[model samples]
Target chain A: MITRLSWVSLLVIMASFRFTVDPSFYPSARSATQAPKEGLAYVAGLYVGTGVNKPDFIATVDVDPGSPTYSKIISRLELPNTGDELHHFGWNACSSVLCPNGKPSLERRYLIVPGLRSSRIYVVDTKPDPRRPTLAKTIEADRVVGRAGYTRLHTVYCGPDAIYVSALGDAKGEGPGGIVVLDHYSLDVLGRWEVDRGDQYFAYDFWWNLPNEVMVTSEWGVPNTIEGGLKPEHLRDGYGNKLHFWDMRRRKHLSCITLGDDYRMALELRPFHDPTKLMGYANMVVSIRDLSSSIWLWFQEDGKWAAEKVLEIPAQPLESGLPEILKPFKAVPPLVTDIDLSLDDRFLYVSLWGIGEVRQYDVSDPFRPRLTGKVELGGIYHRMRHPSGAELTGGPQMLEVSRDGGRLYVTNSLYSSWDNQFYPEGIRGWMVKLDVGSGGGLSVDERFLVDFEDARAHQVRLQGGDASSDSYCFP
Target chain B: MIYEALSALIGVFAGVDPSRGWLYAAYYRTFRGDKWFSASLVVVVLSTTTTTLLTVAPALIALRTHFYTGFLLLAYGVNTLIHGALKAAYPRAHYSGPLKPKLTHLAIWSTINSTLSGYGLPLGALTLIQAGSQPYFYLAYVPVVTALATASLFRGVAHARSLTLNYDLILSALYVAVGAYSILYSLSTILR
Candidate 1:
C-alpha cells in the first residue's frame, strides 16, 4: 500500500512539471506592455579602447532606482577569449515559445551570445541567479563555420523553433551573408537556414511575423568591407541596398525589394510586434548620395511585399571639428544605426549614432511618423554633455526599451573598428537612462549614468523580456 | 500487435458511455420514428471517422520525425490539461435536450460528442501502426467502431443516464493520468 501511494505521489509531482515555464514569457505584446518595469539591464561592454587584449564581458546593472545597488554593476560574466566582439545577444527561448506553432516547454533561461569577430557562440545560463549569468556551453568558431558555412555573426534573434543568428559574410569574409540556425536547447549549430539563396546576399538583421509566416532581412556590407570601417568605394560599390523577404516556415526567399543604390547599407530591421501585422521598419544607415539616414516601412501592398520611405534625417553641416571620414562631406550624417519600437506599438525610437541624438517619433501612424522628442549627447563635432554635467564620448547607438515603455536605455558604441573611425578620441562607453513621458518625450535621468571608463558598451537587454526581445502571436 | 489492440481497446472503452448516451438521445428521445435512427448512427460513425482521417496525416508526419512528435504529444498534454480543468470547473450537465431531430444540428452534435468521447485516441493508435509501416492495420478499427455504434444503439436510455456520473468521474481521472503521462513522455524525449 505504501509503495502504491508513493507511485501516485510521484505521478502527481511529474504532472506538475508541465506547468513549469519562465514567468517572463508573456502571451501577447499588450500583455508584455502591462508587465512591471524591469529592475536590471544587461549591457555588453567591449574592451576596444582599453588598449588591452582582454575578453569582453556582459555586465548586469541594477536599474531599479529603489534598490541599494541602483545605477551600479552588480555582476559581470566575462568570455574566455579576446576579440569575440559580443554585439547583439538574445534569449535562447523567449515569448516566441508561446506562439501557436511555437515549441512548448522551452524556458527563456539561456542567453545566446555570438562573437561578431571571433565567429564563436556562447550559451549563458541565466537561471538560479540572473544577476550573475554563467556560461553553460561554447560552440567554437570552426564548428559554426563548418556547419553554417558562414562567418562574422551579427544579430541573434530567437525564433519559435530555433535560435537564428544572421551572419555578415561567407567563410572567407566575402559576400552572400545569411542566417544560421542553432538548436534552442543544445545550442548546437544546425546549418545554414536558407534553402535557396535567390540573389539575397549581404545580411545584417532579420526578424519575422510568425502568424503571417513572413520574415524580412536587411543588409550591410560583408566582413571584408565593414571590418575596415565604412569606405567611400565600398559605399558606392559593395554595400547592400536591398531588403529581402522570406517565407519563414519554408525557409525560402520570396522576394527582394531594393531601396535603390542611393539608399545604401540598410542595417537594422524591426518588424511590427503584432504577429498579424505584415509591416515592419528598417533603418538605412547613411545614404551616400546625401549623407542622410532614412527609415523605410516595409509592408504588404495589394499582394506583393513593398516598402515606402517614411522618415529621413539629413546631415547637419558642421563648419569645424569634423572627423577625417566627414571632413570631405563637411557634415555629420545622421547615421541611424539602430531603431526600436515600443511594446505598445505607439512610439518608435531612432538612435542617431553619428550626430549624437536619439529621436522619438509617434509612429501611431506608420507612414506619417511625427518627431515628438529629440535629445543630443555625443556627436562627431558637437560632443554634447549629459544633464549631470558629465562628458559624453559616443552618440546613442543601441536602444533598449523597458517593457512598460516608461524608460529607455541607450548605449554609445556601434562597432569596435567603426568606433575608432567616427570617435577618433576613442569611445569611453557609457549607458544612460531616459525618462519617457506618458504622451511622447525624452528627458535624461541625472542620477542614472553607468560609466564604463574604457570599455565601449554595445547592446543593452532588459532584465525580463524587453520591447525588442520578443515577437508575439496575439494582438 | 498487442500494443495496437490495447490502444484500440482503451479508445473503445473510453468511447462506450458517451456513444451509448448519444445513441439513447437519437433513438429514444430525439429521432423516435421513421429512418431518423439509421441516419443519426451514420452521423456518429461519419464524424468519428472524419476526425480520425484528418488527424492521421499529422500523426504520421509526427511519427516519421521525433522532433514534431515530441511537440505534438506536448500539445496534446496541454490540450488535455485544459479540457480537464474546464471539466472540473463546470461539472457535466445531464441535458435531455429539446429533442429536435434536425440533420444539421445532428451533424454538429454528433461531431462534438465524438470528439469529447476520446475518438482522437484512434489517431494516436493509427500513428503507432503507421510507425511500423503497416497501413493495413487501420482496417481493424472499422469493425470495432461499427460494433460499438450498433451495441450502444440498443442500450436503454435509463441505463445510459445512470452510468454517466460514474463514467465522468472515471474519465476525469483518466484525463489527468493521460495528460500527465503525455507531458512527461514529451519532456523526457525533447529535454533529454
Candidate 2:
C-alpha cells in the first residue's frame, strides 16, 4: 500500500517530468511535418509612408518555390487614412495550438493590423486568397477610445477568445496604456484586460510561457511623447524601466522586475516557444546617454520570475570598418530592437537596427546564448550594397522565422518618422530572406528579395506561419 | 440636478468605496513599496469613476417610462443579433455616423453598443431603482431618454455635416490629458 505522502511525492515528480520533456526538448527529424504548411506560398509586408498618398498598406509578395513570378508583388491592400503609421500586426489564429475533439485544425486566418499613431485596426481575411488577402474589417481607435479607453495601438496578438492589442496611451494619447481585447471573429471590442492600473506604464510588447503560467510585457513612453521624437529627457525620466509579469490565464499582475536605469526602454520580448522552458529574451533600445544595448534573459526560478543581463552589445568603434559618415558618432550603437526565436527553440535571431546586422545565437542552453553566425546588411550611416549592386538604405528591424526553422525573413524600416531621424537617406522598400542551416548558420538568398523601391516596409507575415512573439505551443 | 447628485453618489459607492479595498489588496500584492501605485490608484479611481458616472448614468436615468425602459432593454438584448445582421446585410458600409468619415463602421457600432448595453442599460436600471417616488422617477427618465434620442439623431446629422464641436473635443482632450498626466506622474521618479 502506498502512503499519502509517497503518492503526493510521486505526483509532483510526474508533473515535473511532464513540463520538462516537451516536444521542444527533443530534436525531431526536419521534415514536412515540422512545417506549418507543405510549401511557403506568400509573404505579406506592411508598407508605411509608401506610395503617392503616403497611406500605409499591406503588400503581398509571392514566394512559391516553383512559381514563375516568385519574389514579385502580387497584391496590395491600402488603408483609408494617409498617416495611420502602420506598425506591428498579427494573425487571428496561426498554426500554434492543435484543435482537440475532432475540431478544425488551426490555420492562418485573419491578419490583425494596428496603426501605431492613428489607433486604427484592420482585420484582413487571409483565407479568401493567401496571395491576395481582402480587408475583412476595420476597428477605429475612436471606438477603442470610447469603449476600452486606450489609444496609440502598438502590438496585436491573438489570444484564445480575443485579439489582444497593446496600446501606448489613453484614447487621447496618454501614458501607461493597457491591453485592449477584441472579439476574434467579429472584431468587436470586448474590453480591456483586467489589469489593475497601478503604475503600469506604457505597454509595448507582450509574450507568454504558458506552461509556467507566466506572461511578460515591456514598456515605452506615451504615444504623444514618442511620436514627437525620443527625447533624452524621456530616458532620464525612466520611461521603460520595469518589466511586468502576470498570470497568463487570469491576466493578473504577478510581479515586476526593474532592468536598471541603464537598460531603460525595454522593447521586444520573445518567450521560448517550448512552454516548459519558462525563459524569454528582451532587448533594450539605445539610450541617448548610453549608446550601448543589451539583451536581458527572463526565466522562472523557485516559482518566481527573475531577469539578468545575458549579452551586452557594445557600440562599434571608429576602426570597426563602418561607413565614414557613421564614424563621427562616439560609437556605432547596436540598437538591438527586435528578436525572434526559431520554432524548434534552437536558435535566437537579434536585429541590430542601428548598425544593420542580424546576429544568430544558439540558445539550446537558455542561460548562455552563443553567437553562431551574423550577417551585416545596412545601418544608420553605412549603406550595405545588395546583391543587385544597389545600395540598401535602412537597417534590419522586424524579423520572422519560418515554421520549419529553415527560412528567416527581415524588413528594414522601423517607423516612418523614426526612420527619417536615424537613417536620413530614407527606406527604399526591401525585405531579404535568409536560409537557416541546420548548424545555426545564416546566408542570404539573392534570388528571393522583395523590393518595393517606392514604398517603406515595416513587418512581414507569411501564410500558415508561426513567429516567436505570436504563436502558442500546446502542452 | 438629480444627474449631478446621482452621479456623485454612484461615483463614490460604485467606484471609490469598493475600489479602495480591492486596490489596497492589489497594491499589497503587486505594488508594495511603490508609491506610484497608491497615487495612481487614487487618481484613476476618482477620474474614471467620475467619467463613467457622467457619461453613462445620465443615459440610464433618461429611460424612465415603461416604453423607453423596455425599448432600451430590448435593444441591449438584440444588439448582438442586430450587429451580426447589419454586418452581413451591408458589408460595404464601412463607417457611417456623426463620428465618420473619421471613424470606421466597426467603431460606430462599438461605441453605440458599449454606450447602450455596457453603460446605459445597467445604469438606467440603477437610476430607476434609486428614484424612490414614481412621479419623480418618470420625470427623471423623460430628460434622460430625450437626451439619448437627441444624441442618436445628432450622431447621424453630425456625420453628414462633418462638423465636430470644439466643446466636445475640449472635454475629451481635457479628460485624456488629466488621466494621462496623472498616470505618467505616478510613474515618474518624483512619486517613486
Candidate 3:
C-alpha cells in the first residue's frame, strides 16, 4: 500500500489551478490550469490594518483550488499608515521572474507600493524569493520649489525599459497634474511632464501600453480644480477622468480621449484576455461625479478610441424605491472600482466597493459584458455593510480571478483617516477570499475576516455617520 | 530587506503576530494561561469603562480652549527636553530596522507614517467628542486617548526584544517628560 507521507508529497506536487497575482486591477492568465493541485485557487491578497491595535497587514494566498482558504496570511507585517491600504502590486511576473541572463526581472519579481505622505516609494523586492520580498529602494518624492510638500506618491509602473510615476499637482496646479518619468534600471529622475491646457491630470490612474503610447485617465484634477478628494455636488469635478495618451519616447502629451462620459477613477493597461494584446478599462466613469457607472476605454491601437458603456452600476437596485433606506447614498455613485477580463476574454470580473461584490460576466464579444457568474464577498465597505450586521455583506475594493477562471481575491476598506471623516464607521475592513468555480453558478466558498474587532474596516465615506450611509439607490 | 519587511508584515498578519489578536489570545492560553478571550476582555472592559466614564466626567468638559492650550505648551516644552537628549545621544542616528525588529521595529518605520498617515478623522473625532463631554470627561478622554495611541504606537517596540536598552531608556525619558506634560494638562482641566 502507498504511504500517507507519499500521498502528501504527491498532493503538494499536484497543486490545483490558480489565478493572477501582484497587480490588483489586471488579472493575467498563467500557463497551467492549476498550480499542480486539485484545490489550488491561485488568487491571494494582503491587507494592512493601521487603524486597529492589532493592525497586522495580512498576506493570504489561496493554494487550494477547490475549497479556497480564507483569512490566510503567511506573515504579520505591520504596515505603516492608519488610513488607506496599498493598491496594485508592481510587477509583470507571477513569481518574480529571473531573466535569461540569470538577472532579476521586475515582472512578478517584486511589488512597488507608495507611502503616499512619505514622498517615497516602498518597494517590496520579491526577486530574492517568490513568497518573501526584499526592499529594493526607497526613492524620494520629487522636490518642487525645494519643498516636496504634497507630492503624494500614487502609481508605479516598471515597463520593459523604463519606470513611470504620476504625481498629483499641488492643491492648486492649474492643469490636470503632472507625470514624472524615471529610468527603470537606475531609478533616476528622467523628467517632469504636465498635462495640456484644458486637461485635468489626476495621478494613480493611468495605463502604459507596449511600444510607445501611455494612457492616463483624467481625474480632471485641475481645470475642474479637484484638489481635495472626490465629493458629491461638485458640478465641475471631471478632469483626468478622460484618457490622456502620452508618447513616452517623445515625452510629451499627445491626445486626450474623453471616456464617453464618466469620471475616470482608475485605469489598467492589461491584456484583453490574451497575453499578446493589451486593452484599457476606465471605471467609476460617472457624469455626476458619483461613484457608480463606468465606460470601458478599450484600445488595441489603430487611431480612434473604442469606448463602450458596459454597465450602468445602478445606485442601489434593491432599495431603489425606499427613500428612508436609500437617501444618504442617493447621489452617491455605485462604486465599480476595478474590473478584469478572463484569460480567454470571454468573462469579465468586476469588484464593487459600494456593493462589495465581485461579478463575472461573459465578454466573448467586444463592447458587451454579459452578466454570468457572481459572488458577494462580505465587502469591506461600511456604507454597504448590512446595517443589521449580517454575515452575507461586504465592502469589496479591488479584485482578480485565477487563470482557469476559478478563484478570486477582493480587498475592502480603502481610504484612511480621510475616509473616517467622510464615511460611517460601519464596515469591518479586511480582505475577502472568494472561491469561484461552478457547483451552482458563481458561488461564495468562504469569507475570510480581515478586520480587527476594535478598528473595524469601514468605508471612508461612512466616517461621518448614519446620515451619509445609505443614499445610493438607482436602477 | 523590503520583501523581508513585507513578509514579516504579512507574517504578523498571518497568526504568530503578537501585536493584534493572537498574542492576547495566546497569552491567555499559552502564557498567562487564562481562559480564552479572558485577557482581552479585561483590557476591553477597562478601556471601554474608562472611555465611557470619561465621556460624561466633569474634569474634561471645562478644558475646551484654555486648559488644552496650556497642556499643548507644556507638552511642547517636554518635547524640547527630549529632542535635546536625542541630539546628544545619536547626533545623526537614523534607522530602518533589523537585527530583526521583532514586532516593535515598526515604531520608527518612518517619520512620515508616524506623524501623519491616518491621524486625521480620528483625531478630529476625539476633538469633537472632547468638546461634547463634561469637564472631568475631558481630562479622561484627552490623556486616555493619547495614552492609548501611544501604547498602540509603542506596543511593538517592547515586545520586539531586538531594541536596545538605550531605546527603552530614551523611551522612558520621553515618557516621563510627556507624562508630566500630560498629567499637568489633564489635572489642570479638572473641575475640582
Candidate 4:
C-alpha cells in the first residue's frame, strides 16, 4: 500500500515524464488570405535532406491559406521516387532578381532532393498555396558521375537558373565527390562534375557562395559508427572537412576550403560561412558533440576563423540552470543536424535531431553567439535506441527560417535507423512552424500540425530500428 | 592545399553508414522490450544506490545530474543489446506491444553502462569513423565483437532464467527514485 504522499510523488514523476507538445501557432483555420490557420496541414513530413532514392520529398503545398482550413491530401507534387523514401529536401532561389537582397533567391524556388539509396537527383519547381502546393514538372536525376553505383545523393539546392546537389563519390576511384547540374527550365542535364573519382565517402552537405559559385561540404573519408564510439584510426587518418568551391559557369571545381582536421557541421553558406576568409568572429554556437552541443565557437582562433571556444551547446543544458540533455543518454551528443540560418544572419537555428531540441542562437556575432532561444520537443514514452542496442534519440531535424523573419519552419523526424529505434514515432513526422514575430524568442504555432501521413503506411512499429524496420508506410 | 583533397576523401568515406549500425544498436537496446531490461537495470541501480548517498538523495532530481543520471541510459542500452542478441539467436522470443515505458527504462540504464565502461558501442563500430564511408572495408570488428559480447550477456540473462513482473515494479521504483535524486543534484551542481 502506497502512502498518499508517495502516490502524489508518483503522479508527479509520471507527469514529468509525459511530455506535452503543443503548437502555439496552431494556425487557426483562416481564410486563404489569412495564411494557414489551425488544421490547414502544414508540411506533410520533412525531407531530412534526402539522397539518391528520392533526393528530397520537397513539394509545393498549395493550400488556399484562406479556404477549407484543413489541407487535404488533395494533390502532391510527384517526385522522381515519388513513393520511395527520400533522404531530404532543400530550396534555392529561382533567379538573381528573386534573391536581390542576397537571400537564397526565391524567384524560382528550386527543390534540392536526392535519393540516398539510389544515385539520383530530384529537381522540382514549387508554388506555395494553401489550396494547392506541388511540383510543376518532374526532372530525372541525371547521372552525376559516370556510374552512380555505391555513390548516392543527399542534399539539393538551387542557384540562378541552376540546381546544385550534394552527393558522395562512393565508387572507388570514380568520384569521392559529385554535383550534377541541370538547366532550371529545361530540367535537362547541363553538366556533371566529379573529382577524386570513386570517392564514395563524400559526406552530405552543400552550399552556393554566389549565383554561379557553390560550396560543397561533405565527409570525405571518415567512417563513424552510430550507437558506438569514434574510430581511433579514422580520427588520426581524418580527411579534413572540405568546403569545395565550384565554378557554376563552367560546371567545374574552382577551389576548396579545408578545416585541417575537424568535423564540420553540414552548413548553410551565410556571410561568415567561410572558415578561412574574413575574421567575422561573431557570437555563435556550433556544437561539436554532446559535451559541446551547447558550445559557442567550434574554432579556437585560427587567425582566420573564430578565435575562441567561448559559447557552448552541450547535449545537456543543465549547466545553464536548464534540465536538458543531448542524445545517447550516455557518452556525449553527436553533431547537431538539420542546421540552418536566418537570411538576416541574425539567428542560427540548430536541431539536436538526436534529443528532440532546436536551439536558436543570436549570431549577431558569429564567434560569441548569444543563446537567444531554445525549444525542447519531447515525449518519448519509449526512448529510441539502435538495432545494436545503443543510445536513445528522437531527432528534431532540419530548420528553415523565412526571409522576412516572420516565421521559422522545423521538422521533427528521424534520419537514421537509430533514431527510429529511439523514437518509434519518428516516421510519424511533424513540420512545426514558429512565429519569430515575437523577435528572438521562438514560439510554437500550434494552429496546425504537418503530419507525414505516409509514416505509418506499414507496421511492426518499425521494430524501432534502421531503414529496414518496416513501419506501416514503406513496410 | 592538400587539406582540400583530404577533406573530400574523408567526407565521402564517412558518409556510407547505411544506418546499419544504428539499427543494430537499436535492437540491442530494446531487444524484446524495455520492461525486462528495466528489471535487471534495477539491480545495477540498487548496487549503485546502496553505496552512494547521492543516489538516494533526491531520486527524481538526481536524474538531471551528469554522471549520476547516466544510470537510466545504461540500463536501457544493455537491456536492449541483451534482448536483441537473445532473440536473434533463439528466434522464438515472441512478445506483444504496449511495452514502451519499461523499454525506455532499459534504454536509460544501458546507455549508462556503455558510457561507464562497455565496449558494446566501440566494439560495434571498430571501423566506423563518422557515419558514412564508401567501400565498407574499415569497420570489420564491429559485428564480430558485438556477437561475442552479446552472447556473453545473453548467457547471463539465461542464467537468471527470466525477468519477473514483481521485479519490473521494483526496478521502476528504484530508477524513478534515482531520477528524482539526480534532478536535485543537478540544481546543486548549478548553484555551486
Best by TM-score: 1
lDDT (Cα, tens digit) per residue for candidate 2, span B1-192 = 544443333333233222122222222223233343344334333343334345444434454434334333333323323432343333222211111111133223333432322222223433443444443443333234333432343334213122111111122222222222222322332233
Error of 1 at B52 (Å): 9.6
Per-candidate clashes, comma-separated? 0, 6, 107, 216
- TM-score (0 to 1) for chain A, all models? 0.97, 0.87, 0.68, 0.62
- How do the residues A99-138 of candidate 1 rate in per-residue lDDT, one tens digit apiece? 4334444667888888998999988888789889898999
Per-residue lDDT, model 4, residue A63, is 27
Which number leads on DockQ? Answer: 1
* Collision count of model 2: 6
Query: Which digits, one per residue and each the tens of the lDDT, describe model 4 over residues A192-245?
Result: 544442323445555443311334444433223221223334433433344444
lDDT of each: 0.75, 0.59, 0.40, 0.37
Ranking by lDDT: 1, 2, 3, 4
DockQ of 1: 0.04
- Which structure is stronger by lDDT: 3 or 4? 3
lDDT (Cα, tens digit) per residue for candidate 3, span A158-231:
44334555555553344435655554444445655443434344555554443223444445344234334455
Error of 3 at B179 (Å): 69
Q: Top model by lDDT, which number?
A: 1
**Best to worst by TM-score, what's the order?**
1, 2, 3, 4
Superposed Cα deviation of residue A289, candidate 2 (Å): 5.0
**Ten contiguous residues minimizing lDDT sum, candidate 4 chain A:** A466-475
Task: Show the lowest summed lDDT stretch of 10 residues, model 2 chain A.
Answer: A97-106
